[model samples]
Target: MTNRVEYLRSPTAIRERCNELFELAQADQLPYFRVDLTQLDAVADYVIAVIREHYPDLDVPFHSRWRHFEVGNIPRVRQLEQAIESRSKIEQAKAKFDLVIPSVLLDAGAGDCWKYHEATTQKTWARSEGLAIASFDAFCQGAFSKHPYQADATALKQITPEQIGAFFQVGSENPLVGLEGRSALLQKLGQTIEQSPDLFGDVPRPGNLVNYLIGHADQGQLSAVVVLNAVLIGLGEIWSGRLSIEGVNLGDVWKHSSLSGDQLIPFHKLSQWLTYSLLEPLQDLGLKIIDLDQMTGLPEYRNGGLCLDLGLLQLKDPKLAEIPHAADSELIVEWRALTVCLLDRIAATIRKKLGLTPESLPLVKVLQGGTWTAGRKIAAALRPGGTPPIQISSDGTVF
Candidate 1:
């Protein structure tokens, strides 16, 4: 049996740990991605560059299409669509995610506000939007949606305190703000917008607010994880079909596979576990999470069920460019795919060290035990929304 300290010592050992996770994912046929800790700083630097060039603000407003009862005539959506169309699958995915991440954050603020945009039906379906505000105060007793900014009790010309209170209420009969909280929140949301003129112009529009929200940055690792993960979940659900997460059944799938143990250790569990690890941080921040697993898991295959599984990724030709961006080449996609496989390898080893069986250690539990938690914590420090979860920072990209 390997001692815990020994496993925690060397990078080579950690790499081996990653290899194990990949093997496990291969066994379960799960879509896993490897996150390079060595390159994490580099990737973070890239992220920081983009964010600084774009967001550069500590406070950001959360907005989305859900707030817009009607779609305004703006090329913002088209700009995003065009940017993504010219990029690779991974980059395209990221772009699409960036396009609407603010919407996701606002949705989170509205207590998981989601509405099915039916292109087929030409009609959208939405849960009552103000539910978050109403319910939050009730849940935490004026903490979640606390009525802190009291302007007035009743006034016709000026915005009333009663009027401001209604927007976020979960439910209100003789509500204070009534349906006006949306506008008030939208007005308060302008603070984030005005901060970034390039990202979000000074206009009563949706897309710019959306862009500004995306560019906004949350605090540290844990917060980043929460915000990013939630955004990923939201985007996946909106863009892709309903996110079909492979839950406990993944263990059954992993047990029947033939991947080597070396490749399976550390990576498998880590890949799966990293998904929802931000929950603790969100709860710690006094945010009430109505549903822990609202978003489903990803489907980007690494080893188990993709061409890359047959050692195709290892066969790819390597090319170097002075400035590497996802829009540049297949390098990003191939690297991302390789990452998925590698992540699985890491999970398997960690599971063994923890003396956890595959059945006892489902995919969700892995997410709960991983770096996503740390990501959420980091994000909390970056900005309020306690984990950034979906709020866009001027960082300007879907990280």
Candidate 2:
């Protein structure tokens, strides 16, 4: 059971198990979604156009949370670097982790109604951009620390839903979805950090993870999977009411009826997203991030919606789009697994069309210059407000 739990947490398991579903999808054995290989060319064409539009030179960064921070052509990240200019590179890296960890945790989908008015930019932003800017502002104001630029366990433990609501500008007029769940997740983060002193440090800050990774690095280099393992081991307990094996909480993992025996499938979506977000900070410290392709494409709404919107995936019942699905529902799980599988196919086709290798255009870069933006573009054209084709009931944790 312990080994099984550990296996479920791995990228290897994600790809292997999801591929099993993909094969089932190919055989038309799955109950909910149908695989349409005929539409894959069209999907790749659309993604290539988006990549050319966004990056004419084809130089794309990883599809991390940092991109959202740069919304509206602003150099918010550069501004952050300037603010901490006096700090050493390691400290700066820590500060970036401090800011990004919480920001990513709070990054589950903000419903269509919520919008944030940024006082600094005097700009009204919605969706992921709005959430990113709001969290950025809160971090700058020291909402999670006594000091203005760090996230300490002490401060995070005391964070309340009202405080989170206030920092996010949530009110009767402006309601951020899953406000309480967001707050509870942060508080749990604090508790997790406090308990794992070996990972966090004596003072207990999320930034302290910088030291842990640095210690774990093999001569100034680290594998992305190691970083993901640390993230899952250190913070897996923060997820609420999740499946557990041998008392180990399986964060972002779910069940699918198509599987044999255990019938369990792991997406680890937010955890992998957090891992992707953490890499830049490590890179800033001059550590080479090896095996970047080992990280799977995130199975969130944007990537998943792309498959549905492009007809690469067709729901057996179109009415599934008309209602909200729980994050753990079998249909949603199948949809996410297929998204992960199809994204690989899409990435391979995209590379062939662009005359590039996986090394030149890794899945992460494909996500950035490629599929995610394409998904949003198609969604906006098909639906009002650019909403995903499938509606998910969020708790400010899972997407």
Candidate 3:
């Protein structure tokens, strides 16, 4: 018999489990918290205001890690384009795939204090943008490449902790959260790539994923969820100590008691975030990735914090927000699962208020417009450190 945990291995499982939890919450069956669906309108208003302010014409882009790189009006991608101008468009796509896969993997929470100084911009970036730039610079310097002279994919298949640690500035005074785990994760990434010759080729370049998508595309069409599944299957082993069932590693899937059957709930937040990031690159190759809404909202702290900050979700004890919780704690599991359901509700309200259809105002744009930003805004307003309402212990692998 197939292992039950295997169901939680896909994007479908994440959505289904989240929806099941939402229905339970709606019926007041969840014990950790109570959700007031009526309160979502206020949250919607706040997000709508933010969206209009940032995107005046409502022309919002998909929410992805790429946006962090374009911070401060920096043409980061254009700079990359100029650097790789010698390669054909297809090869450029591969190079970008190579660059982005590892970059996105390295993008866990950087805590509040650590900052990156961009020598070129002469500015300091504190959070995600800093990490993105730092990772990009490392990639440009060929940090992921082993030979630095090889023409093929094997170059990226030789990353090491020594190289990644120094490049990320993981040291005593400048501590990065989960530095050890993060370093180990990258080294394992190189190993994972090298082992998958059919998918990654002899050298195991991240860009080779572009070829897989292109070749498997159904009549020039692909689903965003399909991209997410590819990421989960390709890099599942890179995440150390994640859930595995029947010898298959279930990356980013967790267990929650509120739901039954497999007893495993999936939330591949980072992988889905990676899928969202891949949209532009694949589109650059002239492939249309349809069914954007099929991908659920990311269940990270920023989005979950927004619910608590906005009073949409209320903890039973109220003091739970201040306590440190493990990544797998039932409290956080509920919070994260609830965030997924609430995001869909929030998007529905915003779309109705804006007089737009899901076709026009997809959840991607809704997120970019202001849901995540509003979460950050509210956090900074309510908390001193701008941390999430509930603290999570990150292993540099899971957020």
Q: Rate the local accuracy (lDDT) of all candidates.
A: 0.30, 0.92, 0.81
Clashing pairs in 3: 153-203, 154-203
Query: Predictions ranked by lDDT, top down?
Result: 2, 3, 1
* Model 1: residue 360 alpha-carbon error in angstroms: 5.1
What's the lDDT for residue 65 in model 3? 80
Query: What is candidate 1's lDDT per residue for 1-399, written digit by digit as tens?
Result: 234322322223334443454444444433323232343333323323332333344121112232232233324334444634655443333333222222222332222233333332354434322332232222222221122211111111233334334423324433221234333333333333344455434432223322333344343213323443322322222211111223211110111122344222222122222223323323333434332222222222211112222222332222332233331123333333345443343344444554655445433333323322333344445445432222221111112
Worst 10 residues of 3 by lDDT: 147-156
**Model with the higher TM-score, candidate 1 or 3:** 3
Between candidates 1 and 2, the one scoring higher on lDDT is 2
lDDT by residue for model 3 (227-302), tens? 8777877888887777777677888888789897856788998888888998898998888888899888889999
Candidate that would win on TM-score:
2
Q: After superposition, how far is residue 66 of candidate 3 from its true place, in Å?
A: 0.9
- Candidate 2 yields a Cα-based lDDT of 0.92
Backbone atom clashes (below 3 Å) for every candidate: 90, 0, 2
lDDT: worst 10-residue window of model 2: 255-264
In TM-score terms, candidate 3 sits at: 0.95
TM-scores, each model vs. reference: 0.25, 0.98, 0.95
Give lDDT for model 1.
0.30
Q: What stretches of model 1 exceed 4 Å from their correct place?
A: 1-322, 327-329, 359-395
